[model samples]
Target: MNTAINVQGGQYWKSDNAKTWALAIAQLVSWGSAYYSFSLLVVPMEQTMGWSRTSTNAALSVGLLVSGLAAYPVGTLIDRGHGRLVMAGGSILATAMLVLWSQAQDLRMLFVVWAGLGVSMAATLYDPVFAVVTRDFPTSFRTKITLITLVAGFASTVFIPLTQGLVSWFGWRGALIALAACNVLICLPIHLSAIKRDAAESRTEEHKTRIKVEARESTRRALRTPTFWALAVCFTAYYATFAALTFHLVPLMVERKVSAGLILVTMAVIGPAQVAARALWFAVGRGVRPAVVGMVVTIAFPVSVVVLLCAGTSPYLLILFALVYGGANGMMTILRGTIVQDVMWTKGYGAVSGLLSMPSNIAKGIAPISAAAIWAIQRDYMPVEAIVLAVSLMSASAFIVAMRFARSHPGEVRERIANVGANNS
Candidate 1:
């Protein structure tokens, strides 16, 4: 199979750089409108609909859970060369659901809209986009994936303020309608234009047969490995901790008696800090092993949480926490993008990654609501912080274990591929 052929002559953009930029833009819009926009809408929805914050936020949890459930099938589809259709369809659905959510008059309606958005998320969000990059830009996929995250890291920075402005100018409902327009006008076109159609048509039957065998063997091998399960556990716990902190950060700060202005300043630092971290990674950390990066960032999670816990009316400590947390989160995204290729070969990268992401996505979906329940029971953020810190430590430990295991049993798939080539020769 010729990797360069797809880049040179296919339905995708003629240049790899062009395709990368298009997908990066698409990711920014998709994430900004679909996922990050939800948090900004929570207060407005609660105020207008007279629903409790928990009830309103539950809709997002439902959507994320649905997204996690749908991830495997969506990944399988992308593996089958349906990347363009799946992503474009997802954007269209997201647009429709956002419009529906704009007019939601009841909690049930909100749930319905968000439930549909969940499927859209599985199709449009990071997992699907990462799969597309892996499939399309197999040679330079790591750099491309990093570039996408570097841009999309600003999803919250872009949409939080934009959503707030829209709400202030035209109310929450009108703001949602405008977001729907973004999905349709921005995300859908970029996905459709960027993803190449099936490249199997350009390959010989022998090459096609060899690729399929490799993909199947890779998936089978990955499923049977302890490394795969360890990574799953590590990422699941990490995402749960991240989601809980993200959703509850403001409230947690408030409970500590931090003023609203200081809270905003602290929160605003996170986005830029994330972007700066990614830029640094691209400049200096790209040559490092992803497992090394993973272990380092996982440690940062617990340390950042501890800083937040001990901030105690110190704005400097809070800012320091934001920098550490944001930088680690940013680098973690790049690690996730590259780690599968590092630990395993890229034969069935999309499917293998999807399998790994399933539990992680589920954890992300459940973390916020579960953390809220914890806060309700304890009546404070301290216990919640402790819970997150414990999970973060567990996540770090699991990744370290996985890295050691990979070191002892490196290139399992690569060895298999080598043996196959020798037999063929």
Candidate 2:
């Protein structure tokens, strides 16, 4: 029980718990507003624009590609203590882009607007948020991270039905306009109220106002180790596989002739189960090694993929896949951020994570479209499963390699944690 609340400019900065909840609130607001809203718009947009599913989906793909391009750059900006600025800009852009999307007349126009929204997603979404939390709260970033992701997991469940209702009453265009308004009116204000520009600078100055052994080691030596690259490889595969599978999940189900209603029900189980699994991880993960946690989540990829590939349309297997895959994927999001911090502190997070994330984001951007292309070529789901399986195997292998590297690296992770302590102290 640690309770030392310090007031800075009339705001509380002392309690890690408070900061955790605040950041988590921000994550929920940002991700829920952006990512969750996409699925809802997909169906209605297809219906209204009289567009083919591929074209409608192409707009989203374009958005994701823009987002992927934006992730690392946004991460670099966040590292510069301009996270609040980036997030605010993202919210504003997202709000404006939603309005633009409402008025799109053709696929080209829709793709163009979504391309803008992609940039917004990069700035406001999890990558930036992950960078923010890791920088500001060093020691407890993991548990807080887990909590934030757990909350954001509910975005689909909460937003999907709400969006459907809104589109029902107001029509898709009107609903999109209303959603744009909410992004501006709700999300924009929250960011402005909660985040202040000087916060990052003040922390940076405080940490660097003096130098110590840990600081010297973090700055001078950590980069030379193999651990960092190993960790990066692990995370890249994690994101690539997870992103690919998630984007293709629904279509994969339909290809298997799984009924839409059952798919919905099974998919619905994921959010709550994700929360529960994360909570469990938070409680027990502290007792285990970071490598262990990473491996558990990483192996879960193959488990879920294998189940889906082998089990056909069985509801039980699908539900099982949802729980294991969703829980592990949700847990892994936090795991990636924390593992970096656990192994390296906040010193090189932006650059290292950003570099590692670039390729993965590209993979994510291409995953759905690539999966679709594969499906088209094969005229079935078998080839798509092959791709997912290969990706999963690569991820699992990376995790195994990372674990071995961590064990051999000895004091690498502890040294990074010590660097954070030396700064705050």
Candidate 3:
């Protein structure tokens, strides 16, 4: 086994396996506390604070927007041997932000708090973690990535009920405090201890400059590709639908007259279903083509939404929606990490993935507010549901269009991109 100098002055890659699991666990907690817990808190906050749905949702929207803006800079920091700093600092800041969020006394406070939370997300979430893993573990990264996502897929399953139960015991404010404690106690230690970079990557400044220059040119080439834009559209549309549904699902089910117990159960079904589908895909992923998987995953999105729309008051169909929706959403996570590499070259994945994340993160930021606006129009979620269903279809269509451009010619397109970069250089 190849080894590099550790910070301790003596040793090698002793913590690769530990690093993988620690990052996975941190992602699960970070996402669960910062992201999934928002929906459950919405109604409680609205009832207690007398805030409009739009008003409450706007805070998170702003946070997500900030997250989008912070994505690139965070990636750049990770590129500079700061993975431990970024993730550990993100965990600490997330703890502080969650505490502040619990004490939010006004709209301004909520907005400010969530904006900081967004920055934490940019540092700690899947993209940043993936960057650290890819940088630290060049070989066997796909398996590691798959395992990381597979574990973190249970974020919703575990956090949703745990949050609701917290709310039940001590109200929204208390629940957030509990969450903050969990973030600090669980994530902070793991991030600091587990994320160890190989010292050999600390090359001379000239080597670093050359890599950056090449990465910039590669990004430029990707920008000119029709396939990249289609993926941007596909992912943006997918995220819009995803965010809208995630932030609005509980309320939508309530409006449809679903029981509180049933709502929890259905929502809980999502995480396990997500894990199961991901495990299945992980087993058979290499045998299948990415384009085929992409199409199937995209098609699954609208199908799940249609099921939700048609379920009405039926319990069985609602569970069916959870299964399909959760599975699709899980597979989408894997696709999000892989599709960019499949369609584009992986020479500068962090930079390229951050670029794709910009629009998608913005879509996530806006989707909640957009859904709230639609709900406000008729004071109904049916309209919002219709919008979600439409966007899901739009995402599927965008992927189909993207496949048309690069499906038969991924290798050819990659060669062209490399040649263009070489010529430009």
True-structure RMSD, every candidate: 3.7, 4.0, 3.9
Between candidates 1 and 2, the TM-score winner = 1
* lDDT per residue (tens digit) for residues 1-425 in model 3: 32333666532335577667777888899999999999889999999899998788778789999999888778766765677889989999999999998998899999999999999999999998887776666556677888899989888878988999999999999999999998999998778777764366456687578667766766786798888899999999999999889878998999999999899889778888889988988788856877898999999989999999899878899999999998898888888887776676656667777878888999898888788889999999988888888889999999999999986676786785465456334
Question: CA shift at 128, candidate 1, in angstroms?
Answer: 1.2
Which candidate number has the best TM-score? 1
Model 3 clashing-pair count: 0
lDDT per residue for candidate 2 within 153-202, as digits (tens), equals 66666677777888889988888888788678766655554554554456
Residue pairs clashing, model 2: none
- In terms of lDDT, model 3 sits at 0.84
The true-versus-predicted C-alpha distance at residue 23 of model 1, in Å, is 0.5
lDDT measured at residue 273 in model 2 versus the true structure, 0 to 100: 74
In candidate 2, position 249 carries an lDDT of 82
lDDT tens per residue, model 1, 1-425? 11223444544465778778778888898888878887778888888889997787788889888888898878777766678999999999999999999989999999999899999999988888988888776667888888999989888888888988998998899999999999999888788777887655535677557656765766788888888888899999999999999989998888889999999999999999999999988788888878778878999999999999899879999999999999999999988888887776666777788888888888988999899889999698889999999999999999998888887776665685455445334
TM-score of each: 0.92, 0.87, 0.87
For candidate 1, list the clashing residue pairs, or say none.
none
| The candidate that achieves the highest lDDT relative to the unseen native structure | 1
Per-candidate Cα lDDT values, in order, are 0.85, 0.72, 0.84
Task: Report how far off residue 76 is in candidate 3 (Å).
Answer: 3.2
